[model samples]
Target: MLIALFQILDFLLRIVGWVIIGQVIISWLFAFNVLNASSSGVRGFAEALERITAPLYRPIRKILPDFGGIDFSPLVLLLLIQILRMLLGGLAVELTYSDA
Candidate 1:
């Protein structure tokens, strides 16, 4: 059903949001030298996170002007994700009500 599909999408969006948060934290840890990127496990985890987030961040990074070292792509991506979720949720509600 459309509702079930919407639920699945919402869950996925939440998971991706968490992944982005984790990626940001991990990057900070690495930068602060609290986490060693040279370690195999650490490197693997970092690489995986990069792989998951890179696709979403790439286009935003291209459009936004670089601010020296500060990357705003993640924030932009999160905003976009929230907007998509709101649009999908509204669509789901409208569909449900129209069926009544």
Candidate 2:
């Protein structure tokens, strides 16, 4: 049962990681003028991503120093997510061994 829980958490973390990646790509597109900022569709998509990721980035943003116009919150969040995933994986391994 605990293993199943860990699997679920891992899957959710993967989804969050993808969402962060999507936001980063979208921001790059906007920055490069590849995506139309005037378009409602593009604006809506960007807004949605911002809303979803804002909470996750808030704390990290506070802790990280500003680098001109650059944002490192997403990268920091991704790294933290990877670390959590590794911990979950290790715990799951221990559980599997103990069960046997």
Candidate 3:
């Protein structure tokens, strides 16, 4: 049914939101040196996160100016992910109501 399809789409949006958030947190810690490069677990997760987040971040990352030691792509990427979550969630809600 339409409601069930909406649920699936909503779940996917939520997953994307969570991945974006996790990427932000992981990138933040790594950028700040809180996690050492030699920390294999963190490194692995970062690598995985990179694969998911890179396509989103790459274009913006290219245009950003280097602020000494700070990286801001993750913040921008977080904002974009939030926007996507809200927009997709709204569509999902509309679909549920449209079925009525």
Highest-scoring model, TM-score:
2
Tens digits of per-residue lDDT, candidate 2, 13-84, equal: 999999999999999999999999999989999999999999999999999999999999999999999999
How does residue 35 of candidate 2 score in lDDT?
96
Ranking by TM-score: 2, 1, 3
lDDT, model 3: 0.79
Q: Give the top-scoring candidate (lDDT).
A: 2
Choose 1 or 3, whichever is better by lDDT: 1
Better of 2 and 3 by TM-score: 2
Q: After superposition, how far is residue 93 of candidate 3 from its true place, in Å?
A: 5.2
Off by over 4 Å in 1: none
- The TM-scores of all predictions, comma-separated, are 0.96, 0.97, 0.66
Tens digit of per-residue lDDT, candidate 3, span 25-45:
887787789989798987998
List lDDT for all candidates, in order. Answer: 0.94, 0.98, 0.79
For residue 1, give model 1's deviation from the true position in Å. Answer: 0.7
Which prediction has more favorable TM-score, 1 or 3? Answer: 1
A best-first ranking of the candidates according to their lDDT comes to 2, 1, 3
